[model samples]
Target chain A: MLSVVILGTGNVAFHLAKVLSSNNSVELLQVYGRNKTKLQAFEPFCDTTDNLGKLAAAAIYLVAVSDGAITALTQQLAGLDGVVAHTSGAVSLEVIDHPRPGVFYPLQTFTRDKKIPFAEVPICLEARHPNDLRLLAQLAGKLSGAVHRIDSAQRRQLHLAAIWVNNFTNHLLYIGQQLCEEKGLSFSLLQPLIQETVDKIQQLSPKEAQTGPARRRDVQTIQTHLDILEAPLQKKIYQLLSESIKSTYEKEL
Target chain B: MLSVVILGTGNVAFHLAKVLSSNNSVELLQVYGRNKTKLQAFEPFCDTTDNLGKLAAAAIYLVAVSDGAITALTQQLAGLDGVVAHTSGAVSLEVIDHPRPGVFYPLQTFTRDKKIPFAEVPICLEARHPNDLRLLAQLAGKLSGAVHRIDSAQRRQLHLAAIWVNNFTNHLLYIGQQLCEEKGLSFSLLQPLIQETVDKIQQLSPKEAQTGPARRRDVQTIQTHLDILEAPLQKKIYQLLSESIKSTYEKEL
Candidate 1:
């Protein structure tokens, strides 16, 4: 098994360490985090490190830190002889400023309790050299069936796209939950509709998948929906998104 | 099994009839629709009818017709002796234009092929009379584990909430997918994040569950995302939603 060291005790690091440990292709050499308590339970599972210097001992260092710290971490690991990579979708390869650096970003969100399988997650990879790139690709392939050589530019774009689809869309659901709560209704009613919205994209394009009055550009329904949203910011968001939907489908409609 | 007659053969009608037919509680007396082809497959399973007057035979009549024809369909079924209901969220009992009225709205998106368990769905009920309400509630209980009694006014609010959470957010996802496709990326890459955005709400409240630059109020990261949108409309959406997220988390941040 190829030996691996993962830095950070955040959700991704926690999950990646366990998953890599379970799989026969890789041996999780060390788990690192600044705060010892956060890495307490995990420490017994593998060799643990709090100091940055110890990270260089492994064949590969997976720096699963926050986006802001990735560059600094890479620079700190610059003298390390082995391959060093961060698991950030937003940051680029050149930003690494290290001897041999790349990205091993699993294109999935990680929660502390949720153990996401790497096999289903697409690993977006980039490297400075051909051999290192091939190595990263091979490592990603063991974890995931889906792997893509997304450049720094494309990775940035994916991060931005993720905000729209994940972050923004989640807030919209929050608004719905707020609206429902205000009217003495549970947010659970919206789950089925949410499932359909997702299922629609499996076959239909997003444009064709769109439903409701906004896609139809029905002002009366939009007005009614606006009336229901008492919160000023929520109302503003509702109007702005409704306008966006209208303009997208109006020409085709 | 209660004798049930379902009006219309659209998505809702097709799914409801199938679910009800599976249950020992319901025997679909007839299915009425204009499209013979749509109703053809359902003939052997239930009594399929093109005639409106023939709906008088069932113990309970469920008009799953479009919002536009809801009033007209109820008016047509007004002469029938049994209790009658419409499967519409927005339309009121008074709008049904009937002497005996109720609502049997299954609060979920219905697709022809995907068969969700009736028990998993929340059925919203409202009736003109106590006995009628009791019967509708029983029928809804038979079909779903969760049943909500919402008035016409509250139901409208629920419908509007569905528009925000379901329709509008889906359009945003569509935008994200189109943006990705424009830059030569597949929509499937966004799936895990999408599912996570939804799954988080089961444990965390939406406000507490916020992630990304907007929640952090990281203007630099937000700007980086905006630069990649490329489309003018996409930029506007990104701006509006980001501002909304900032406002939601501003005090906490």
Candidate 2:
């Protein structure tokens, strides 16, 4: 059985602790957090403590803290003889101040209230030694269906892509919701269309799946849409994205 | 039964024809398309015509052509007793020259090969008279679970919002896919995260759902991400969106 100890009490930490504690082939030895109240949520599932010096012996020490806290937290585990790893997409594995530092980044968003099924999440692993990489992969395999040994550079690129797909895309949806609210239309009306847009990508590449006035270069409709948008930021965004879409298609043609 | 004659053989027309013909309360009288080869796809299921002059008489003439073609198609049915309607989100109702003009816009993207169940699609209806609106709504209700009475102004606004959510969101996915390809990572690795992003918005408002380096105002990670992106356009987009997200949360604070 793979023994693991998780640090931090954030969304990622909470989720990792729950999944590690529940897995049949894994033993979650302890969970460490700075805030006592936040650590309480992990207490019922496993041994919990606010003191990093009191960390138990485990095969792996998984740091699931914020990017800023990761380095300092890893520093506190200087004496631990385990494969030290941080669960971050953007942060590099070099942040871990240990001889056997590694990464166990799960490329999925975690919310405190939402219980995500660990099986479908892709676990990206990295390590300095072959044995440590294999050990990390083995533990990740137990909790997830997919795992990859990605370097710090590739992981950083993946994190950037994640922001584009998740952060930027959600922002567009927010803009759409605002427009709906101002025009007295239910935002729910656009849900099916949004779903279909994602669905199309499953069958066709996003380039092939693209459709709209922008893709067709409908100048009249584009002008009309620009006229309708009252917000300067919204108009600028609309114009820029529309131009981008048009250029993407224009290159293909 | 409400008799309907569908014009055009595009994605919208193809899907609408299939759904209307299947509904017991609606009789899909005929389908018209300028191209004979495209019309053949609809021939096996219902009557297909290349000549608009041979258009059958029905209670509603649904013009499901491109936005530019809507006016001309509606003019072809000028003297028909049916309630003439164009299925367009951006085009105003005044484009339909008929005295009894209406709209039967289904607010979902349609692809020819992908068979979308009409029951989940939201149909937006508008008309010159209340009776025509009711007639269009009744037919729309048979095929869809949700129907809304939206005027030309509201429909235009909804169309603009659709561009933001559907078109712009898809483009972001395209950008993400490109980055994944460049880094030798499978784009599928990001799918679960993308799904979670949308799922979160379903429960929380998009504003509340927003989370990322930008939303947290993590300038260090933001700059790191921007540095990782080599493309000038990609960098510009990242900066603009990150600023937008930062400003959005700053306002809330």
**Model 2: which docking level applies?**
medium
The TM-score values for the models, in the order shown, are 0.87, 0.95
lDDT per residue as tens, model 2, B157-245: 89989988998999999999999999899999999988887787777888887878998888899999887788777777788788778
Clashing pairs in 2: none
The residue-by-residue lDDT of candidate 2 on A1-253, one tens digit each, is 7999999898899999988888889999999988999999998779998987799999999998889988877887888898999999998888888888999999987777777878999999999999999999999999998898899989999998999999999999998999999988889888998888888888888887777889889899999999988877777777888888888888666
Scored by lDDT, the top model is: 2
Error of 1 at A197 (Å): 3.6
Model 2 misplaced regions, further than 4 Å: none
Clashing pairs in 1: none
Query: For candidate 1, what is the DockQ-based docking class?
Result: medium
**DockQ of structure 1:** 0.54
| i-RMS, each model, one decimal | 2.0, 1.1
Distance from true location, Cα of B119 in model 1, Å: 3.6
